[model samples]
Target: MDWLLNADTNGEKFLVMLAAVGLFVVVMGAVLVAVDRPRWVPQWLVVLGFIGPAVLMLVFGLVYPGLRTAYESFFDRNGENFIGFDNYVRVFTQDEFQIVLRNTAIWVLLVPVAATFIGLVYAVLVDRTRFEAAAKALIFLPMAISMVGASIIWKFIYEYKPDQPGVNQIGLANQVLVWLGLEPYQFVITAPWNTFFLIVVMIWIQAGFAMTVLSAAIKAIPDDIIEAARLDGVGGVRMFRYVTIPVIRPALVVVVTTIAITTLKVFDIVRTMTGGQFSTSVVANEFYTQAFTRFNFGLGASMAVLLFVLVIPIVVYNIRQMRLSEDIR
Candidate 1:
């Protein structure tokens, strides 16, 4: 019994050990029951008994914590005081908060459209090429990298150095400017523009994902329609305009809306690269900074709630798009 609350073990470690011991006990008890051949219980009951633990685990682990966070959102920094609309009001009325909202809007708007457009073009061009797989793999490689890792890589790409003669430009963008005989620009440190630059990283990563989805959609188009279009002298751009675009509309909608949702929740790229500085903060990153960094739980909750509210329209649109897809099928 003393081992259950041992002095050498922290609460986390104790809980972990207890879980392991409980698992062992359950396994052994199950084996014993099997050996004894108890006929009173049905086989389905035994199977469900095994599954019950996993269901309970999810309810405790995921459902509980999310509910707890929602409850805390109405509370103050220490989660003691109740300040309902004040935090939410500050989110809209405050200049800095407005900037965060504006940046978030830019990210949600630009990243999805730009990424989807690029992906659609790339998918159409590469669909029947001899090097299609290689081209797609090259494009889709970014999606393989996590957002945090991609942000670090792009941070170096947008890196800046002082205008001093001795130090070389660290950022690839600045290096390119130097090569083109233009002055090196401070990318991350620049206001407003820096937010767009961060968005470029997300676009770069998500373009691959959009490409994969749209490319599959393109391939699923009937050969008969393409042939009919070509026979009608719609060979190149006109063929794509008349044939491919309409055929893959459902997939395009899914890609665009999925990327929009992802862009709305973007935090790692902003957090890792800019640390929410230089007015480059978006709703997701600002929520973390306000709630965790500044310990202003109420303000952070309001920001999160705002984000949730914004995403609802997109989600509804996505659902409608999915229903249309099912009808088409």
Candidate 2:
């Protein structure tokens, strides 16, 4: 019992994880055995057996928490007194929050587009190259590392040193400048540019995902379509532009929209690198600051709701594009 409440230790967390797995297995096994031993379980009950646990998990995990957060968004900081819409209004109109929104906008705009484009080009270049396997693996390695780990690695690479003579520069960025006979620069201390550097780290991590998804999509393109294009004298950049991109257009949209949603909710890179300071705070980081750091639960709830609202349109667009692409096929 104490172990359940004390999850700070790795052992306790592992134990709790095991208990959860054990509970799930027991419940599922009982359900299976009961269903099998029954005289004649109805078809609806069989279907329910398959979906019931998932529905229960969702109702308890997502639906209730989402509704509660929405409700709390209209209340005051402490959630005691009702303060309708004040938190929401402040989130939209306040100067500090505006900066957060601005950073979030930059992330959503840049991460998806840049990552997807770079990935598309890389995928095409290495599709059947001599060193295709090795090249793709090297590019995709970052995705295997967690975002927090990637941020830490890049942060070390972007490390800054005072431009003092006779001092060896430790950070790679500074070291490069030193090699070029220029003074070492502060990568994280600089304002908006620092945010861009953080964005680059995200791009590096997400480019692999985009590349993998887009590569599969490209491979799934029909062999006849590509041959027909070549027969019609379409090759090189023109073929890629007209044929390859169009054929994989649905996947492109899904990848972009998926990355956009991921970027909108990005927190780890910013948190690990900048701690949301110096105008680098985005909506996700701001939400954490409000909810946990500042103990402003209501305001945090509003920000969460705003994030949810922001993702809806992109998701809807992705669904529409996917359906339209299917219709075209």
Candidate 3:
């Protein structure tokens, strides 16, 4: 026991030694079963032999690591001196943390609804048209790009240069403003509005997914219902409003909830484009900044736990909606 507690091991070496001994015992038992004339050994023993490796791997890999992270969230960065909910309090009270929470709420509210609405509208408008596939393919193209890649592309679009002699603006948005005889604006650096600009990247990527889902839901509507509606003189905007929207409500809910979940965990675009600067940080990016950049592991973990708490209800609701939709169908 004294040897196991010695500074040379730091306790981890003892765990390793214990594991090695257990593994050796298991292996030797298996070998003896194979080599010796052991008629009494049952088939369940062989099944246990196969299951042991997998069980050990799972305990060592997932279970151990998750427990360790949760444990570390209670301690300081160096894993010393327990300081309970102080990290959580810091997250709520600090100005920077408040900004993060506000930005996250804005993102949660804006991106999903806007993206889903745009996608649904686009899908319905193009549903029976000649250019439907082409339109959808074009819109869906952005989803294929990695988040970092998309951020870089949008960064170029939002590029800003101070008004100078003979410097042509490379940013498309500023170029458009210049064409309209307006002064060029620095999109990324602008506070309050820059967050929305960052959000555009997410919306651009997610809108296509929403469109595809809603389009499928629309197509799944029975042709007999459409014919009956037409027979009753229901057509145009009235028919769509009275009929199409009601039928596709399930899909709309799914799309909005899925987008909300995605928005809650959004980190890459903010990290790549803004580096969590200029009041553009959200919870996910703030967690990274706290955990890795500032070495405030406890605060970072609390942020992570907060994020998980926020997301769980959304996911559970989405699951219930899906099940209800399935039952209705």
* Per-prediction TM-score: 0.85, 0.93, 0.82
Per-residue lDDT of 299 in model 1: 74
| TM-score, prediction 1 | 0.85
Which stretches of candidate 2 lie above 4 Å from their native place?
7-20, 38-45
lDDT for predicted candidate 2 compared with the true structure: 0.92
Instruction: Give one digit per residue, the lDDT tens place, for model 1 in 54-166.
Output: 77789899788657766767777778898767777788899988899899889999999999999999998898899999999999999889899999899889888877789
lDDT of each: 0.87, 0.92, 0.89
**lDDT of candidate 2 at residue 124, scale 0 to 100:** 94
Each prediction's total of clashing residue pairs, residues at least 3 apart in sequence or on different chains, is 0, 0, 0
What digit string (tens of lDDT, one per residue) describes model 3 on residues 197-247? Answer: 999999999999999999999999999989999999999889889999999
Error of 2 at 47 (Å): 3.9
Clashes of 3: 0
Between prediction 2 and prediction 3, the one with superior TM-score is 2
